[model samples]
Target chain A: MIRILLPAHLRTLARIDGELLLAIEGEATQGSLLSAIEGRYPQLLGTIRDQITLQRRPFLRFFACERDLSHEASDTPLPGPVVAGEEPFIILGAIAGG
Target chain B: MSKVRVLVGTRKGAFILNSDGKRQQWDVSGPHFGGWEIYHMKGSPVDPNRIYASQSSGWFGQLIQRSDDGGKTWEPVGNKFAYAGVPGTHQWYDGTPHPWEFKRVWHLEPSLHDPDTVYAGVEDAAIFRTTDGGKAWEEMPGLRGHGSGPHWQPGAGGMCLHTILLDPSDPQRIFIAISAAGAFRTDDGGATWKPINRGLHSQYIPDPNAEVGHCVHHIAMNPARPGVLFMQKHWDVMRSDNAGDSWQEVSGNLPTDFGFAIDIHSHEPDTVYVVPIKSDSEHYPLEGKLRVFRSRTGGNEWEPLTKGLPQQNCYVNVLRDAMAVDSLDDCGVYFGTTGGQVYASADGGDSWNAIVHDLPAVLSVEVQTLP
Candidate 1:
């Protein structure tokens, strides 16, 4: 199980004000995490991915165990700490401009 | 030689990047503002020694600080503009103050026309002008004259005024971009504003003018041709030939074709630059790749100029105000990536070199002629 903490906006969209829970069935990577999250919360499909490319949106950031999961592959294995459920993965909406 | 310094603002602090124009010759200093995020900043153009920075922490409210004596020390700027008054102003606050949505100032431009005049685009979706420089700011009521229905405001980021293009030749003819509200101009010294968003693709719909969908992230204009403007809209790149009254798409041929910051050559009207991000997915271009393109012929076509950039998959998010053009004839084009690397092209984007690297996530980059 990969516990995911969402930022304020995503939390509202997912209708979950707190950390979300998702079963990690296959490989753990940015792509997998997003697909899983969107699969669970269908409304958030186009919100994160472009529907066509499945690429993360601009100003959107991903983190797992304090690591920026934005640049990492979706297939990258979950950190041992995350695999252990010590610290949950986090998806953040990066604040830009002034 | 005068030292080259770049200010890199981040959540940790406002950092300083010092370089000697060489490889990895970079020195990053300071969590300058302590823990508060310094998003928008400007080293005083009139007095290069003084620096002005605006900070906000969601609920902590907004505050602008000024540093005299070359950033060695700093102090709060205005009393009315602060949650707590500093010295002259009487306003005070007992707890953290949350800034009004779209209330934080994003960019500060000291008036080249009047040394005492300064203008700032705040998050509250208004443009504030300060006659006494960074002292007190009043919302330019003229902006409200532009039509904005409920559908005109963007979903998020607020349909606020973020770009302020002050005509150096005729200060009265000012151009500003208010995200989803569209591009506007005040030819009579900001007394009235008119929409200039024609031909700009509205991002929310198939139509180009989608009431509140065409977000103009930033706009730049040629100082010589005050009427011409280049704007980076939420959907595409455009140019206004008639002083921002109407626009035409100019992003002819560029990879992915999505980005925030677009810069025009300081001296050349036809030559300009844009940093293209991946449009299919906005996650910092494709595979965290970085590329800054050059359009030597006014965006009719473009060529990728990434000879000396990074080779690894890296997200290079360059803010709207982060890319710059130095005034040298060969025209040095410089930009700082969100990955904290500053790349400079001494020969106009033909070949590049990393002037500095590893600075706290850079927010903005501005270069000036040092005496």
Candidate 2:
């Protein structure tokens, strides 16, 4: 089991509208973890990652174990803590300015 | 870091808009240099204490203003920063001398490498630079149009430069994109300019390759990787790998690549952000929906962020200078629309809040982390 935290904006989209928990059936990886999360929250499928390429959206950032994981490859395994269900996978929409 | 105030230049005048952390309230001030049409305003990123303003009149020529004490008060910086020639140096219209008395310094950019140097793209259809902190300036001769006889008119946005991005790593290299004219690059500090629009298609000519006049509205470069850039062209979005030396059309998956500005993630050189809209029409999002598109791995992929956003008809056009990102660990993306709404995403983009509604047309929104 893995916990997933959505930005305030995504919370409104999932209709789950709150903290979400996802159960997976594979080795921990951005792709597999995302698949399980999206499988449960179907409406969020194309919003987070491209449905076709499974790529994170342009303005979105991913974090794991308190680190920026958005730019890391999708195939990268979720941190061991997340795999062990001790930590949650965090997906944030990146905000930018000068 | 201190409270970063947003400098907005508009038709009314220059305005200093301040925001409380979450954008709960925005304090708008000025018409600072009233009576002049202020086109470009900037607060130096390296030195928040200094600010620059660009203004022009169809009859009075061009002027720039500086504020040392923020925007609480402003003073005209004088001919030192103004672009002008004696009365009859160039052809005149409407009985006034000087080439079409400067309409606007369409774009003003501060060099990332040397904050002392300031660049302004103006209406005389030329680019001007100031080295001694706007205390006197010189023109980059190459920015002048080679084939542009007095007869060739400035296109949609005027013979103006709307965007200029400086390379932080290499001070000598720079990219300048002018509307109606092709893009150009100078690797040796404007000593010479080389046309860098090889792959950028021009809509003016029948044979795309042969066209010379391509309109580029705005262009952005990653501070991390100077050469990696994106441009919102007339009909498409082009990514340039060798600075502006060459470009590749990457709007394959976009609902529409027609946009005013292109911004990249502050930390990630490959990530890009854009507000897409159909080209021919008044540039509204496809399906009447307002969405900000993202390409995480350098245009290789794109996805929309509609979470916590309006699901109904969205008729707001966001100017390139208006959208911004907080980039906090969880990063915050905020952008204001012509509809007078400011929307923010606290979780890098996962969720959003309509922080402020029904404000004046928000010309720009820049956030600064205060110590």
Candidate 3:
């Protein structure tokens, strides 16, 4: 099972409380995990990433295993802890507003 | 009891203000969709319970929220707005060709007769229609595909189609206004369009009387007289009597003509309202006083409505889509300001009061008269 942590607004949108767990059929890369997430919650198709370009929105960041994975490639494999569901892949709205 | 529900969209969230027909003593609901930018919210004229809201953010892109039971509950609808065909480029600010991209929905005009059908005017300049209550949207490309699209440019507000007017007399006719693209009319639904800016003069543009490049801030038409239209341009107040075939300047008497919002009284077709800003560069009212100018003659002669409003030291702007009217016998006028104030004039424009003093910089105001 791969665990993911969504931002507050997205969690409200998906109507989920606490962490979300999903079983991955293929390699647990950022791209595949996002695709699976969107597939499950079709309402979140374009919230975290672009629907066509699949690029992460400028104001969103990704983190896993105490490391920032936002700058990493979408196809790159997630940390082992995140893949094993020991740690959550966090999707965060970037901190900029005062 | 017949009641009035005021739907307000602000910079931070959406608010629902309810009151009886007396127009006094109100009950305020929400900051629903809190922390998100609610660009515009409007209820269908056919079904007052059905409401559509445009919610967007820099991080989450765009979202459409619909409420079937007035403003009590809401659910997210389709957010995707794809342009038709090749999605060609328009003129960028720097004179370069910019590819068309969907940014956000600036306005939503529900069908006059069909509750399920709604029209959306979006930024980056496009019109989208949804037949299944915003579940899906398809572009009416003829407005942009009529061969003059390459010359359309953004007017500081980023190429937004902010106004959409449906002709009540002729269901087949529709009018849409874009910033810096003037106004367009489609006689055959959305299949064909023509520029209706015949006499608009904009000194800022290369050609002062160009047919296609004037920044039309807002356009209002009386349902009883669908052929007559009133427009508040970037620097002039105008009127068209022959269904936009030709326009004549109506910026007469009192104050500057620069403003954003314009609306007509529901009960009186000749009575129109406009908020004059200081100038094209300064968007606020003159001398720190916020006043709504009313022209009972429909054009030229005007009077300022100032009772129950801020008379001094005010520097707020009323956006193009931020004003609306409720069709009560007394005729209530409502508008929201950039300083987070929603003002309501219960007895036409004579007496005014702020329904809410503090919100998140209101972007739009819509009213529904309940039976």
Local distance difference test, candidate 3: 0.92
Instruction: Order the numbered candidates by lDDT, best leading.
Output: 3, 1, 2
Interface C-alpha RMSD, model 1: 15.2
Q: What is the TM-score of chain B alone in each candidate?
A: 0.86, 0.83, 0.99
Kindly give the stretch of ten consecutive residues in candidate 1 chain B with the minimal lDDT sum.
Answer: B83-92
Sort the predicted structures by TM-score, highest score first: 3, 1, 2
The digit string of per-residue lDDT tens for model 1 on B1-371 reads 44556665665467666655432365666767666667766676677767777765452335566777556666665513321111111111221232333346777777775545677776546677778756776667666535442234542455456788878788687877766667777889888887777777764554656543467878887788877788777657788788876778887877666788888887898787888877624648666557777887878598877788875677768877788776656677788777777788877788888776766666777765445
The fraction of reference A/B contacts recovered in model 1 reads 0.00
What digit string (tens of lDDT, one per residue) describes model 3 on residues B1-371? 77999999998999999999998988999999998899899999989999999999888899999999998999999988888888889989887899988899999999999998999999889899999999999999999998888888999888999999999999999999999899999999999999999999989778888878889999999889999999999999999999998999999995899999999999899999999999878989999999999999988999999999999999999999899999999999999999999999999999899989999898999999998
Worst 10 residues of 1 chain A by lDDT: A45-54
Best by lDDT: 3
Q: Candidate 1, A17: how far from true, in Å? A: 37
Ten-residue segment with the worst summed lDDT in candidate 3 chain A?
A: A43-52
> What TM-scores do the predictions have?
0.70, 0.68, 0.98
In order, what lDDT does every prediction score? 0.67, 0.67, 0.92
lDDT of 1 at A13: 39
Q: Which 10 consecutive positions of candidate 2 chain B have the poorest summed lDDT?
A: B87-96
